[model samples]
Target chain A: MRDVAIIGAGMIPFGRRDEDTLMDMLAYASLKALDDAGLGDKSVDAVYVGNMGGGMLQRQTAIASSLVDRLNLMPAAAETVENGPASGGSAVKNGLLAVASGYYDYVLVVGGEKMREVTGWRATDFVATMTHPQAEYPYGITLPGMAGMFTRLYMEKYGVTREHLLAISLKNQEMGTLNPYAHVEMALDRGGIFDSPHAIVNNPTSADPLHLYDLCPVSDGAAALILCPLEMAKKLAKPPILIAGFGQATDTQTLQERDDPTDLKAVTLAAQKAFEMAKLKPGDIHVAELHDAFTILEIAESEHVGFFKKGEGGKAAAAGKTRLGGQMPINISGGLKARGHPVGATGVAQVVDIVFQLRHELPKNRQVQKAENGLTVNFGGFGNNVLAFVLRRVQS
Target chain B: MKKEIAITAYKCKKCGKLHYPYHDRCLACKSREFEQIKPQGNAKLLTYTAIFNLPWGFDQRFLILGVAEFENKIKAMGQIKADSVDQLKVGMKMKPSWEPIRVQYGEDVYGLKFEPME
Candidate 1:
């Protein structure tokens, strides 16, 4: 099989975008990526759209076909990928395999979710649909509820505290201010959100242990990438970022079924497979973007991915180890906490942010100096499904 | 008459791995054959949370939910009979009951419920 490389990446700002429809967001991001690749008059071989709630929220389906037609890219094969929150990563994986197999020379992978169009309650219910129909959904278990339980367990077993969680919340939200594309631009203050007398009102509990700030906001946005053979990418003007390795894994549908509920086995397996295929260890990674849908997840995934020892991830964040220019700068784009998680768009947006870092195009604040390699973890269905990718900047 | 827990747990005949809510194949050994069994005795609370921002269907301000492991090792999720998460603790004993967890179309949906047992 041939190697796949990303030639171009594009993303629109993430927030409550009431103006753009799901198809419009996908088409806009795709056009930006196509233009970024300098494919002015050229068309892709196929199109893959990643979406989770088009039919549920917008009453629209077959988004890939709609996007291809909207972008005037007729005749190209079109397909939509849905894997809960990992839809974007799954779509990219499809595009990568298609290009690597030599079946499609150029593939456009776009992920977008117009979640803001629906009420928060509806969105929460929609996301909860991923849970076990019989065992979990009936219990009214939302994602935050799952995270809250996980957080409680982690605290009891690993000694993780609210202070450690606060560190990530502050750090990521602060980074968000520097990110123009971030949905939450306001930086959180310790006094206002935690220490002050009015803290109760400021940061009310959404889930028992996790507060409002601990969870990511519902957002509407889209991101796209243009992928081709590594050989073909070299001919392009922009430096190519090779998809060095990728891995996808699944765990039990219900967390209670796992022997150890705190163990995010799928995350460990997926990251391990990606690292093994890349022939690189976690330490070798220059920058990383973890799926931080909840603050506790960032800590848990950081440990599961081998960035830190188990039980140490929370402390690491509290000590500034995961901050930009620190030991391993994570989520320099503000992560899901601040950048906003538009489910389908998040996986693609993570890669797009990394591409900017690897390309050395971002302002010094967000860019990792002379970064060579980056990694991304896109989590789905709680920890039931996960995907990991290792990207390397090809030195010209 | 006291309501009996209606849940059925399948034990993998090959590997002895127990499963709740019925799995087509055993998760550990992938055995096609299994011994059906009922969750026996009181359970231990494994984890729990009180969700404040509920979904569209739930009208209550908050709902307490948890997972518990029974004497026979049949683990399942259920609504916790507690005023708050403070009333629940991991590893604490819990009495499991079959009762209405929610209402759908004016019909009660019966599921597992756990009450703390001192």
Candidate 2:
């Protein structure tokens, strides 16, 4: 099989984005990537659009085909991938395989979601559709509701405190201030969000044990990457980032059905598989972007992905071990906590950020010094469907 | 309203693993044959949450959700009923019962709910 390499990465600022349609957001990111690749008039061979709610939120289907036409990349093979919040990661996985198998020369992968166009309640409902219809949805369970329950279990079993959660919230949001495209760029203050009596009013509880800041905001944005065979990337303007290895795994549709829901077994399995394929251990990773849909997730996923031992992830975060320049440097892109989760866009956006880090293109403050290898974990559907990727920079 | 919490579970004929919500095949053994069984008696709550953000059809100002482990390796998610949020705790014994949880599509929906075991 041919090796797959990323040549260009692009993303739009994630926020309310009231004016842009989902297609428009997708096209803008795609064009940026194409321009970055210096492709000029060289159109892509295939386009894979990762989207979760275009049909439900935008009332538009056949999005991949629509995006291809919109981008004037007609006749390029087009398909849409949907795997809950991991849709973007799944799309990139498919793109990687397509290029690796020699079936496609140039592949364009983009993920975008326009959730702010609808009411927050509607968007919540749209995401919950991934849950078991009879077992979960009928009970009025939402993603935040699920994460809150997960956090409670983690706390009970692992001794993770609200203080640990607050650390992730404060760190990610503060880091968000450095990223031009982060949704919530303002740094959070402990007094306003936690310490003071007005904290309750300022950061009302969305789910018990999880205040508003613990949860990622509903956002609208898009991110894209251009993929080609490693040999082809050598001719590109930017240094190529090889898709070293990837893994995807699924758990039971319902979280309760798992042997140990708090274990996040899928995460462990996926990361293990990716590491094995990459011939690299978790300790070898220089920086990481974990799916921090909820603050607890950043902690839990860090452990599940083997950055820390079980029950030590929260402690690691509390000690500032997950921050930039720290030992592990997790979520240096502000993560879903402050970067804003546009569901479909999160997975691809994660890879794009890692690509930037590996290329040493991020600003000094945001960049991991001499970053060589990066990891990404895009979680979906309460840990039911998850995708992980190991990327390494191709040194000249 | 009389709420009857009758949960249908399936024990894989090959692996003997039980699925609470029920699946067509056994995830462990890939066995398609299964026998339907009812999860009985009380279970221990694994964890819970009080969700202040209600869904589209849920009218409750805040809803308590819990996951409980039942007999024969069965696990389920249901509403947790209590007088005060303080009453709910992980590892506490809970009894599953059917309760009116929401009104959706202009119809009352009933589902499994958990309460402190009597």
Q: Could you give me the TM-score of model 1 versus the true structure?
A: 0.99
Clashing residue pairs for model 2: none
Candidate 2 lDDT, B31-67, residue by residue in tens: 9999998777778888888888876776668888888
Fraction of native Cα contacts reproduced by each candidate: 0.78, 0.72
Top-scoring candidate (lDDT): 1
> Which segments of candidate 1 are over 4 A away from where they belong?
none
Q: Candidate 1's C-alpha lDDT?
A: 0.92
How many clashes show up in model 2? Answer: 0
Q: What is the C-alpha RMSD of each candidate to the true structure, in Å?
A: 1.0, 1.4
**Who wins the DockQ comparison?**
1
- Please write out the lDDT profile of model 1 over residues A112-149, one tens digit for every residue: 99998988889999999999899899879999999988
